[model samples]
Target: MTVFIMVADVFTGAHVWQETAPRLAAAGSEVHAVQLTGVDAGRPATSASIDLETHIADVIAAIDTVDTASDREIVLVGHGYGIHPVLGAADRRPQRIARVVYLDCGMPQNGVPALATVPDQALRAQLAEWAQRGECEGELVPPARDEWQRWGSTAGISDAALDRLTALAAPQPLGTLLQPLRLTGSVVVVPTTGMLCTRNGVSIDLVQRLVDLGDPMLTALADSQVTFFELPTGHWPMLSCPAGLADALLRAAAGEGRSLRPVGAGVPPAHLRPFPLDVPELPRDRREHVDLYVPDAEGPRPAVVFVHGGPVPAGTRPTPRNWPTLVGYARLAAAEGMVGVTLDHRLHDIADYERAAVDVAAAVELARADPRVDADRVALWFFSGGGLLTADWLTKPPAWLRCLAASYPILAPLPGWGLTGSRFRPARAVAHAGALPVVLLRAGRETPEIAATVEAFVTTAKDCGAHLELVDVPNGHHGFETLDPPEEIRPALHHAMRSVVTHLTS
Candidate 1:
């Protein structure tokens, strides 16, 4: 495997690359570390203040020096701000690059900005300030040796290695910080996991949210042909957990889809289960049908209805990825002797798309009328475009449906919000906000339109006195399954559902 390591801002030059490259080389990977100009190390890059274009050129130059025609495939790995240059370089010479690994960074799609698309203005301002001052010489300047040493050790790094790193580091250029990348090809992401480390102590809840949302973007990229791996480690894992990090990269080069456990394979974590159900058309303008997944049990249980994204007429069903989560809940409910239900509604008929809200409302009525269900504990789990239907269903929902969980849900038909251009406007989602306790989750790395759609729902619903919590999980994409499901992401939805159950039953 030919692994080319791209360092992030303020961590550049031969020193950083030298340390990382040789290790990968020894591990059977032909390695190269890209040193971008602009950030002043001990020398000047070009005396000209560097920009995004310059940084991009710097990456290309490094790649050009490598013998890509050799038997080995080239694996490009970028960390944080390094993604900008790597992406630019890949766009220019995608054919030469086999796998682009984004280390602790979200994989941006075809056209996306480099800056964090976070809505928090204060955070953005802080970042802008950091970018403005982060670079000095042609080389990237790392943090003070002491700070890095502390970071490394905490991340499971060795002291001797830290001393070595101190000697071989350089300053990075600042101009590349604001560059917008146009990624022509897909890139796999290894997102920085754990915690929203504030100036204060760790915010456990915030950190969980970040990890949950951030990890999903990796899945989305994988779906786009860019595979991903969910490594549970903090930022700069290479320093803190070098052995683990190296092994992961090496395994990635070897094309291992899932993480490899150590010698002792522990018992597999408990998984969710459910029996698939098929529902026939009661009556329709034309012959239409529906399928449902009702939890297996001896008695009636609470049901959760899901509305998938896209026009109902486009044909939608609950995905297998979601089934595990739903099954987890169903199992939990069943353990407590409660029922779990997943319903499919009519939207395949073109006429029903516009009437999705009404159609779903009728479905809830059907769920409520079903003798095998407990009407009081029913809830709504809406995803993407289906969010519109969910939001609308909540307007005057059945006596049941005590809670609503919108997974990357769309809130309105506002321009750029997904449903506006679709056959049915999403505004119906907003018109009915005061229905139940709502938990909204948005992908921290989703497209602007999707983010805005989710944001609209949270903002509007919050104002209506609904019990609401908005969690921004890093690495999540539109449907929230950007990459394969990691266990960390699973618990959040389960907790959210359990919270709803507790709130309703209590």
Candidate 2:
């Protein structure tokens, strides 16, 4: 028999998993929803001074309850903020885990600090939203009922359930959100997968970003074993559409492909051959013609335009080392019959960052106009400098583009490590903002020095009113392009991407 361990997002107790566990159990899988340190499983409660180590210990203790059966393996699923604790538990007992899934969340890299890798524009608004609820010693309080609904999707849940969630949600442990996770061994070696629900009224854009980032994090492996699937539901699939969500869990537990659609629903968009698009020239006098990939057989499918780093020269097409995490996403989106566009934006030297931002914005407008693309569902995918550019574009973007999926984008103006002439400052970016759903990913292992910067951004964003998700991946790096990453990295990336994709597409 397969075992399922469920973890709740921050401020949400184990009851958040109440509506989800039985569905898995009915499908011949054993499910366990764990409550981290200082959180009560039944009633609403809050904690203070609780740190990552405390949460890690709680997860470890929960996992120990599972009986050791030589025949089958345990599948641990960490949702939202719980990813940090779940990963720490796996690190302590990697051998016991059959596979790990970060339901809409990803693990952090070593040496990187906090969830700072995500852009500031999106994060700032979210921080401000949380702060309005009232601050308890620096950390923002959880949202009220209407506030949660505004930022999150509450589809299938009853009115009473929604009220309970709002009433019970409390301020999360400030230290835990700021803590960077550390991975001990090769966690990816265990079969890992990411499941994203891409229905309306969710956080699909953020999920896709994590899915694409999975490529580089999982490149050490020869063949792509990591599974990435999209569900047409909201972020809280368990609460929104429990039956469809349970089906996905069963498939992953069985190591089966998740391409099949919801219960009786038709299959996802038919697979199409990877048709290459003619390179498009940049408007104005720029000398660059970006390499473009747009699907051939289609009437408006979900479309995404990628923006790579370096303004003078656009970042290269995702290679296994640099962008292996994106392969499954591009393939899956293509399979879903969506128009996928990858472009080279001018690098730092070729054009000013602002100019590059305009270039990306133009690409969004172009994608929105394409017949094979869904102008209403267009998304922007960016990383590092690309992230910086995307945020800049979002600040004053054209009216057409709908959502953004920016991965580890640079928002501040301070110089990054070893990279002179580049500036990133967290405090200055969120000075003005609006409602934007953003999923932020950061590695604790690679960029520890920037942890403070990320925290500042997250706190500020919470202070603002925006939808936010902050994930900490252990053994991760600045770009997550390291060779032979501890196996968990890519799976976590897939998890995060799946979450963003759900929000954007749904």
Candidate 3:
């Protein structure tokens, strides 16, 4: 029989496992849920001063309760921020633990605080500053009941459950988040299992790609002793799909889950590979290294500024202006008697979007000032990750900005990206785009993470009665503009361009 020791997450108590615990107990296994200080409903965390070490002690105690069971197998499962305590206890008592399961959370490294795992740059920065100033000694309030999505993905969770989650949520000890998770590195020998919740922006496919990158920290994830499973629900699987989680946990304890292929098993990500599109080569002038595909007919023509999606590598050659897809779009616009402009903005890292937005805005200002451009009739088309930049324009579109277009774009930050307070979230800002015509090219075959953003934007837009047009490429992939063969994608591509062109010229 397996003995399962569960650790709850931040702002939550052991009750979070109420739905899943019984199932494990009924399977002839022992289940114990650790109730860490500052998060227990009975404890009343009204000014709790707890920290990481406190939780570590709590988990150690939980482990002790089942430690005397000589005939039973012991497994430690950590969900969300609970992984810190889980890992800490496992480190101090490795000999007693058979396997450590990282449940829907990042692997906790030694000497790093749980707060470092926060996905939002703005919120993370503020918290870090507060921690530095000793302000984190106070309790950090949880998000309001209805705003659960802001905390993490709420896919699979119903409103009633959400309301309960909010009502029962505790005021977390900011110190707990601000303190480092110290490990003695003794748990290295412990086998591990991971459950990825895809709807919350993590998937085995994404993990495989990251492992292929050869990042040292992620490389260990490919080891044979580390098994993996995928759950299609969002965060809080115990609440959303408790039964499914129970079965997975049982299979995981039995070592029945899939082992990730070797580190170099997969090729580089599809986006980093060569573009598959074929477009006509055209003579174009590149001022300041930016591509300006000019029409033969006239000057002072309407220019469509093309912004490439990326936190692409800062040094990736053949910058956005030169990519075949951007090149094709620029040439297409030029062919239609309009100027198409493409510039390489410095959006090289996930956290660099804010500065990258500055670069994009500057590029647009420069495009408007160009002597050959008609500043009054310009359209801005963003691609891929660049889709986030649409927020600034949508929020307060200038009279001179005629239209906005995005092709398989990431309108909202992924739940795992830690961007709860990011201004770059276009889905939230799209409602502000009242009369500004917007065109979105959606890839039916898009990754679930990016698709979630589209779903949010579309739903919000419809609710607000925003004038939005969608071009669905039934078989298109996320980067289909460059990845799909021109023949298969041309019809949708042409329709999107025509819509933008009509908005620009009309």
- State which candidate has the highest TM-score: 3
**lDDT comparing candidate 1 with the true structure:** 0.51
lDDT of 1 by residue, 1-506 (tens): 56554545345453444445657778877766665664535335665577667777877887788776677676767765666777787778777777667665544555544544212233334545655675422323455666552222123346776676666655544455444566655332322221111211122322222222223432232233433454444455555555656666776666654322221134221222222221221211111222234445666667665555543223222332244444443444444444444444544422345566565666666766677777777777776656656644556555566777777765654321212234343334444546457767767766554566566656666665656766656766554443425543555555665665674566
Give the runs in model 1 whose Cα sits over 4 Å from its true position.
1-5, 9-14, 17-19, 40-43, 117-121, 125-154, 157-174, 184-225, 259-506
Alpha-carbon shift of residue 15 in model 2 (angstroms) = 0.2
Measured with C-alpha atoms, the lDDT of residue 402 in candidate 1 is 77
After the best TM-score superposition of candidate 3, give how far the Cα of residue 118 lies from its true spot, in angstroms: 3.6
124-224, model 3: which lDDT tens digit per residue?
A: 78888887888767777887876667557888987777888888888788888899889888999999999999988777866764565455667788898
Report every candidate's CA lDDT. Answer: 0.51, 0.56, 0.83
Candidate 2 per-residue lDDT, tens place, 1-506, comes to 88888877766877777767888887777877877666654422354566666777777877788887556578888776677787778878888988777675534676432333222224433544443443313454676675553333344567777788777776666656555677876675677767765432212333333333233443332224555555665456667777777888888877764331221133211111121221222211111333234545546677756666543222323322123333334444454445556554555332256566566666666666656667877666666545455445435434444455655555543221112233333333443445555566766653322344556667877787545576667666555533225365666656665665675577
Best by lDDT: 3
How far out, in Å, is residue 168 in model 3? 3.8
lDDT: worst 10-residue window of model 2: 269-278
Q: How close is candidate 3 to the true structure, as a TM-score?
A: 0.81
Error of 1 at 96 (Å): 1.4
